[model samples]
Target: MKVTVIVPARYGSTRFPGKPLANILNKPMIQHVYENVSASTLVDEVIVATDDERIKSVVEGFNGHCFLTSKEHATGTDRIAEVARNLSTDIVVNVQGDEPLISAELIETLIKPFQDDEKLQMATLKSKIKNQEDVTNPNVVKVITNKNNHAVYFSRSTIPYNREKIEVDYFKHIGVYAYRKSFLFDYINLPESILEKAESLEQLRAIENGHSIYVSEVSNELIGVDSPEDIEKVEKFLKAR
Candidate 1:
């Protein structure tokens, strides 16, 4: 099955305007994400799905493929879905444009399972929470999975409630995801669910709709660029490397 990695970028950001185009070590941030994902041997194609012409131009400037979509999209999934609809790929991986330190190897790992499990419709990554305080942080979304690594629930509050205060392991959800072409459409078409609205998590839409999300535990030690300060961190890492 063919795999396509689409990095969804939007120029309008309330916190960091023109974030995708932000320069990191003299290169645009989107370029870093696109180049890293492109290095993945598992993927057949990489595209930047964006709503801004400026973003499109920057992507094209580096000879990378990019397509413009409707600006009204509420989420990156919606934007990538619009682009994937016209493609002939079987699997679509959503790689965030803000991840300058995104790993190509992890992208391969994200989609490789599709070859073995034909019934698997979706998959994502999870990291064990080493910091106890992060388990209680609202910004840190917690996920609980079943014995088969299928997600049971994802919430900002402490999952499984640890009411007994016993030692327990927690995993934080990573936003990246891969979906079968058919299931991707099925997901985008479904109305937002109550759990999704309550948690403000888009992935919950799939879980609430009775779809299982298989998660792969991965230790991804990288900083995601969210603002101008983040760029400095990315640059420092690159310089150190």
Candidate 2:
């Protein structure tokens, strides 16, 4: 399959403005994400989809490809859908701009489901929840999968309740997503479902609409930078490696 990795970046953020331009180890955070995603053998191309010229300029400064998108886009998926609308690739991977520590192998794992099942429309990664705090944290989205490895539901609250068994394994949802080009366009038009609005997760809309989302289990721990405080953690991780 012809796959394109689109990193959605924007200068305006509620917590940290110019987050994509934030420097980590003397290099822009977006550059780190772009480079890591580019390492994937499955990806044919990587591009930054942003509405800000500053982000576009920085991406180009590093000799990376970027496309100027509409500023009115409410979500990163919307921005990616706009870019995917003009692309000719079969699969579009939405690599989150905030995740500077994204793994290429994990991305490759996400795309594997498509090759095996042509009927699969969307897919994402999930890792076992090791941190006790993450289980109850609203910021950390959790997922439950069926026996077939398809996502049954995604929620901020801990799933399965574990009333009978006190120690049940829980899976944390990874934000990275791979979508077929046709599904990408169809997803943007789907009305925001009640479950999605309740949980504040866009992926829930797909599940509510009868679309199957395959969840691939990965061992790597992925950290996404949502605020300025997260940069230090990411930097420490990079320095340790």
Candidate 3:
């Protein structure tokens, strides 16, 4: 299957405005994310799908492929669906623009689920939450999976309510997602379900609609720039390594 990475970058953000344009070292944050995905051998090509012209220009300045999507898109997945509609690739990986430190190996790992199983329509990554603070934090979304490694549910609330034990292994959901090209169109059209609306997670719509999502456990903790302070953390990480 031809795997292409599509990054949905928007200039306007409620928490941190102009998040995509924020400088990390010398380059824009989105550019760093684009370059990281571009370096991956698993991805056939990387495209920046955005509504802003400035974001398009920044991507093009670095000689990267970009597409101007409609501003009406309610979510990142919806924006990615627009780009997927025009592309001929079999698989589209929706890499978040905020995560500049996303590893190429993690992209490769997400792509592997398709090779192993044709039944999986979508796939995402997760890591076991070891910290006690993370377990109770609503900001950190947790996941519970079935025996087959298919996700049963995803939520901000701690899953599996451990009445018996205080420390059962908790898995935090990572935002990176991979979807089959054909499924992308259908996913966007699906109406939001109660669980989805309550959780504010777009992926839950797929689950509620009876689609399967395979989970891959990744070791790396994805560092995403949610606020201006996070830029320094990413810079220090990059410089140290």
Candidate 4:
């Protein structure tokens, strides 16, 4: 099946303006994300979907494919769906543009579940929470999965509460997601979910709407740029590599 990776970028971020174009190690953060996603062997095409012309121009400047999406989209998934709707492909991957450290290998890992399970409608990555502090950190979204590896729930609060002190492990949610092109449309049509709104997480909508999301556990910890401070963290990682 053909897989396309779409990175949704917007210049207007309430926390950090022009975040997509933020500089990281001398290259635009979007450029770093685009180039890495392009390196994924499973991806047949890689494109940037943005509402800003400035973002579009920069993407083209780097010789990357970019599509200008509607500014009305409230979420990054919506921005990606606008571009995916016109593409003739089987699967669409939404890789956050802010994650300059996202590796091609991780992208490949996220796509593997679909190859193994044709029935999987949506999939995303997660990593075992190694640090005790991370388990309680609300900023670090945690996810729990069932025996089938399907996500049971995503929450800002620590899950599996361990009220009885069992051997349960916590997993921090990775933002990258893969969706069957048909399911992508289905998701957008579903009404805004209570859980989604409460947690400020888009993935919760699928769960609330009675759809399953496969959560693949990966080892790599990718730093997603949410604010200016994160750029320094990314630069340090990149420089060391």
Candidate 5:
């Protein structure tokens, strides 16, 4: 199956304007994300979808592929859907531009579910929540999965509320996602669900509509760049490696 990775980058961000162009270890953040996705042996192609000329220029400066998308997109998924609509690939991987630390192995793992289950429409990564602080922090989206490893729900609030005090592992939702090309187009057209709007999470729309999202457990910790402060943390991680 042919797979393509599209990184959505926009110059205007509320938390950190021009974040995709932010420098980390002297290299643009988007470039780091692009290179990481390119390292995936399963990905046949990688493209940067953006609405700004500056971001496109930077991507091309690194000899990376880029496509200009609409500036009116409310979310990265919308931008990716527009690009996926024109592509003929079997699977489209939406790798967030801010995730400079995303591993190629994780991308490979996200796409592997498709090879085994032809019925699977979407998949994403999840990691164990190591601390109580992150579990309670609303900024950290939490997810719970069924016995089959399919996502039961995604919420900002801690789920499966520990009333019984039984030992349970809490998983934080990783933003990277893989979807079938056809499903991407269909998903974009679906009206935003009440749950999705309430949580400000697009993935909830799929869950509300009865579509199953396979959750894959991964060991690597992903640091997504949300603000200028996050750059230092990412830099420290890079320097350690």
Candidate 6:
């Protein structure tokens, strides 16, 4: 299946305004995200979906493809749906604009499930949570999958409960996803479910609606820049690398 990676960027971040254009070691943040996704072997095209002209100019200056979207979007998924309407690709991957260190290998891994399963409608990545804090933290979304590796539920609370300390793995849901192009409208149009509203994890809508979302286990660490405090760490990491 042909895949197109779309990075939804907006300048009105409550925590960090003009975040997409913020420089990391002199290069813009959106450029870093674009470069990472563009490096993926699985994606055929990469587009930055933004409502601001400043973001459009930054992306265009780097010779990256960008689309101007409506500023009234309530969520990133809705923002990408507009861009998906204009594209003809078989698969659409939503790559977060804040994830400058997002793994290209992980992006490639996300697209792998679609290659063999025609029934798969959506897919996302998960990494093993090593500590009790991350497992319990509401900020870190947890994903529980069925025997066939399809997501059963997604929540902000620790899943499975570890009732007996049995040897089981706890996975934290990564904030990247790939969806079948045909299901874009269906996926977005579905009314917000109780699980989704409660957890604020949109993937729950797919689970609540009885849609199977394949989960790909990956080892790559995702570093996202969400606040001003994270910039120095990212810059230092980038400079060292």
RMSD of 6: 1.2
- Model 6, range 9-82, lDDT digits (tens) per residue? 99888999999888888899999999988898888999999999999999999999999999999899999999
Q: Could you give me the TM-score of model 5 versus the true structure?
A: 0.98
Instruction: Give all candidate RMSDs, comma-separated.
Output: 1.1, 0.8, 1.1, 1.0, 0.7, 1.2
> Stretches of candidate 3 above 4 Å error?
none
Winner by TM-score between candidate 5 and candidate 4? 5
Model 2 bad stretches (over 4 Å): none
Residue 177 miss distance in model 2 (angstroms):
0.6
Summarize candidate 2's per-residue lDDT along 36-112 as a digit string, tens digits.
Answer: 99999999999999999999999999999999999999899999999998889999999989899997898899999
Worst 10 contiguous positions by lDDT, candidate 3: 159-168
- What overall lDDT goes with each candidate model? 0.91, 0.94, 0.91, 0.92, 0.94, 0.90
After superposition, candidate 5 runs with Cα above 4 Å error: none
Model 2: clashing residue pairs? none
Q: List model 5 lDDT by residue over 1-241, tens digit each.
A: 9999999998998989999999999999999999998999999999999999999999999999999999999889999988988888999999989999998999998999999999889999899999889998999999999999999999999986999999989999999999999888888889999999999999999999999999999989988999999999999998999
- Candidate scoring better on TM-score of 4 and 6: 4
Per-prediction TM-score: 0.97, 0.98, 0.97, 0.97, 0.98, 0.96
| lDDT winner, 1 or 2 | 2
* Candidate 4: worst-modelled 10 consecutive residues by lDDT: 160-169
Error of 5 at 230 (Å): 0.6
lDDT of 4 by residue, 1-241 (tens): 9999999988998999999999987899999999998998899999999989999999999999999889899898999999998899999999988889888999998899999999999999899999999999999999999999999999999997898888888999999999999999999989999999999988999999899999888999888888899989988987888
**Ranking, lDDT, top scorer first:** 5, 2, 4, 1, 3, 6
| TM-score of candidate 3 on Cα atoms, chains taken together | 0.97
lDDT of 3: 0.91
